[model samples]
Target: MQVNLRFFASLREALGAQRQLELPEGATVAQARQTLIDLGDPYASVLAADRAVRAALNQQVCEGGAILSHGDELAFFPPVTGG
Candidate 1:
């Protein structure tokens, strides 16, 4: 399957830009992240453990169980902190 991916804030700088990615059959959000982690230096910084980045599936904040599908839009961003 394939999914549309987006990066926001600092994550966007690290990821360079959002684009479509091919995912393994039935891959979960977490699984897809591992692939992203290998993308490059940008990905390494974006996916660093200290960041605790957030993900949304089709505009909905999703958890570990979030399933992936063709053409699904997924976004990654750092946790919101403003009051």
Candidate 2:
């Protein structure tokens, strides 16, 4: 399956604004993240398992375990903080 990936904030700086990825059937958000991490370098550093990152599926906030579908839009960004 193919999905659209979007990176925001610092993640965008580290990775990029967008890219297309091919994942196996029934891939989850976590699996997608792992796939990028496996790329090493900036991808691994920015998306390290220990880092606090947030994900959205099709513009809605979702958990890492959330299942992904073909052509879905997946976004990754750091948590927002404001007062």
Candidate 3:
């Protein structure tokens, strides 16, 4: 299955603004992340398990366990804070 991926804030700086990814059917957000991490370097560092990365599925905030679907829009960004 193919999905649209987006990166924001620092993640975008490390990775890019957007890209399309091919994932196995039934892949979850965590799995997608692991796939990117597996590519090594900046991906592994920016989306590292130790970092506080947040994700959304089709504009809805989701956790790592969120299931992904074909053509789904996935976004990753650092935690947001406002004064």
User: Best candidate per TM-score, number?
Assistant: 2
Clashing pairs in 2: none
lDDT score for residue 80 of model 3? 95
Give all candidates' CA lDDT scores: 0.84, 0.97, 0.95
Cα lDDT of model 1 by residue, 4-52, tens digit = 9998888887665698889888888887787877776777766865669
- What TM-score does model 2 achieve against the real structure? 0.98
lDDT for residue 80 in candidate 1, whole number 0-100: 92
Residue range 1-83, candidate 2, lDDT tens digits: 99999999999988889999999999999999999999898999999999999999999999999999999999999999999
Q: Which stretches of candidate 3 lie over 4 Å from their true place?
A: none
Residues forming the 10-long window of minimal summed lDDT in candidate 3: 39-48
lDDT of 3 at 40: 97
Runs in model 2 deviating more than 4 A are none
Give the per-residue lDDT digits (tens) of candidate 3, residues 1-83. Answer: 99999999989988989999999999999999999999899898889899999999999999989999999999999999999
